[model samples]
Target chain A: MSPKDLEDRLVLAIKRAETQLPDDVVSALEKAHEIEEGSAKVQIEAILLNIKVSRETGAPMCQDTGIQTFFIEAGADFPYLGKLENIITDAVKRASSEVPLRPNTVNPFTGKNPGNNVGRYVPYITWDIVKGEECTIHLMPKGGGSENMCALNMMSPGRGIKGLKRIVVDHIVSCEGKPCPPTVVGVGVGGGADLSLKLGKRSLLRDVGIRHPEPHIAELEEELLELINESGVGPMGVGGKTTALDVHIEYAHRHPASFPIGIAVQCWADRRATVKITKDGRVEVI
Target chain B: MATVKLNTPFDKKDIQNLKVGDTVYITGKMFTARDECHLKMLELHKEGKDIPFKPGDMALFHCGPVVQKKDGEWRIVSAGPTTSIRMEIFEDEFLKTFETRMIIGKGGMADRTLAALEEVGAVYVHYTGGAGALAAKAIKKVTDVYWLDELGVPEAAWILDVEEFGPLTVTMDAHGNSLYVDLRKEIEKNLEKIHAKIENS
Candidate 1:
């Protein structure tokens, strides 16, 4: 395929991600709106309305457009292997200036320069090699409110199942309204620090109300959801019955001595969009 | 008159008179500053340079907006409020120096901010955080901008003429009652009941 064709596909893909709200995120917001009651109900209604206005008006759902991170699945035979990285970086810079996305990136140590993609591991592009002729990209704009609530705990293996539940639920309860509930609770279990954290964030990509394929993990998801909602963290941390819209868990093998669990909470605005590029250079935005 | 008239050190009686859902059309010169701008404003005040726009009788919005230039001027694209808790640390001293009476932001702050509001005769208004474009439309004109060269658009405060600018909700009144504090307490109580069940189970 010609480089022009490839660049055109890339640009369209970025714009499509910007303009469209992903089905999963929209459905999650709708479900969150339906289940909420009382003042929480009002909050959700307003939130939904705000989202509608944002969509119709072509403004970002939140002022903090957040760090533009991409998770990519690419085929080994992908036409533009070396160029995709620069294409993605260029897309981010263009989006930051054009989409008028907030320049959220700030330097850590110096406390100066707004490089515009400056979080710890920001504009984070996670890549996976797949056996296919197509390249797919998932765009997730992770905001600061929910990102602030992310944490990890070193639990004893002896504490086992019950201890794990307590740690997850307790942290959600403590955060209350700060993370901007109702939230999707992503729990990472049995991995080392970095892996566990990735697992936690990866869990958020799951569809709302969808349970894990594994019965055991699914059960844990349910129990945690029930426990978290019971906390009354409610919509925007107001008084109500439902604090969490859903709970997702992902796990990995770890050292026998270590039981590292990471929690990444996402706010009600959970914005995500995806796009696929064909070998022929046609772009499909999902 | 080109300017809107407002007074400083607003009293409880004045605050009580103000409703939660009141439309405010502000004209008197107000500073547009958020996190970084506020820090610089403080430094300017410390050095005894004439601070931009007197804080008394002026409004400050906790916003970092999307701005663009047209015909040799900058304009707001989406200038909605940001979460105010991040500013909770600087509010006490800032309010005193700025002598502010109205703070517009989303969500709410802690008791300390409420106390500071009471002392400063200021009220906290909750703007819809995500409705940036809608909010930006209300601002009629960009009169001036401060700290533009060094700090970039998000940090610099843009002075503007705002008309019917707000249907802002008052989350904290000057008398010291805060909706967020009460709401959080209620949520905590309900949380305990849920934990009790989990423990018993």
Candidate 2:
């Protein structure tokens, strides 16, 4: 496939992710709207209206527009293995202007903005190689308010499952409305600090309604979901029945001495989109 | 549940009249400033140099907006309220320096900001978070922008002309009362009780 075509395709995908709340996110908001009352309900109305206007106008769902991050799954023998990074970066820079994304990337020490949203280590990409001829890319625009609530806990091996529950609940309690509830929480267990946080954020990429496939993990997700909602932090943290829309967990092997848990969070917008490219050079955005 | 309209450069009477949970629709001038802008303002204050714009009855919004330049003119595409807690340390000094009467942001602020509200006769309004488009709808014009080169788009101080911009709730009032503090206390108290019950069970 030509570089321009791939770059244009990625740009389109980023714009979609920025403006539209996927069906699953919208459906969840609808359900929450129906059951919510008082100030919580009022907040939801504003959110729903914001979504409607943003979608219709192709404006961003939120002002932050978040830092753009991509997860790529490329076939082991995929062509253009070397060019994928440049293609994504070029598309991101284009999107920053064409889609008018808020140029959020900054030089941490110097506080410099390149203005095109591309900087050192920006448009962060996570990659995986698989046995296939097609490459898939997922774009998630994560707002900073929610991202700041992310936490990693390295507990003694003795804490076990019960300790995990305690830490997760405490984290939510402390977060309160700061992260913009009803958030979708992603919990990663057992990995080292960085991996755990990455896994936690990766969990947010899952389909909204899907729980962990394992029985034990799924049960924990369900229980954590209920417990978070019951905290009464509600919509936008004012107070409501939906403090959290869902909780997902992903794990990796860890050192026997450390029981690390990471919590990654997404605000109600939870904007994301996926695009798949075939070796035949066709690009399909899902 | 009460609805009220306020113009910029609020009088003491206007600010003192508000209470927690009061719905406020603000019009006239409200400037957008965030962490970086606040720091710059404070630096100017230290240097004893006059900052741009008029003060008094002024309201500042904690936001970093998605702004684009078209034909050399800036337009606001999104301007949602950002979390205010991050600015708690700087807010008191800012309120004092800018003579700001109100602060509009997403999450509520901490003790320092609440104290600033009490001392400075200002209020903190919690604009519904994530309603960037609706907020942009109320903006009549991007009157001016400053520090674009220094702080970038989101952090730059974008002076705006907004009208009837609202769905803002007065979570902190000038009368030494804060709904956020009260609610947080209640939640923490409830949490302890729940924890105790769990332990007993």
Q: Indicate the residue-level lDDT of A64 in model 2.
A: 81
Instruction: Tell me how each candidate scores on DockQ against the true complex.
Output: 0.36, 0.60
Candidate 1's TM-score reads 0.87
User: lDDT per residue, candidate 2, B1-201, as tens digits?
Assistant: 577898886888888999887888988998888899999989988999988877554689999888877899889999899988889888898887777899999878888888888888899988888889889988889988888878777788889889999888888889888777777776777667656544543
What candidate 2 gets wrong by more than 4 Å, as runs, is B43-48, B193-201
Determine the backbone clash count of candidate 1: 2
Query: What is the TM-score of each candidate's chain B when compared with the real chain B?
Result: 0.85, 0.94
lDDT of 1 by residue, A206-261 (tens): 77788999999999899889888777667666556667888999999989999999
Tell me each candidate's i-RMS in Å: 2.9, 1.7
True-vs-predicted CA distance for residue B144, candidate 2, Å: 1.7
Which lDDT tens digits does candidate 1 get at residues B148-172? 8878877788886676664466667
Looking at model 1, the pairs that clash are: A105-A118, B32-B157
Off by over 4 Å in 1: A1-19, A31-42, A111-122, B1-14, B18-31, B163-167
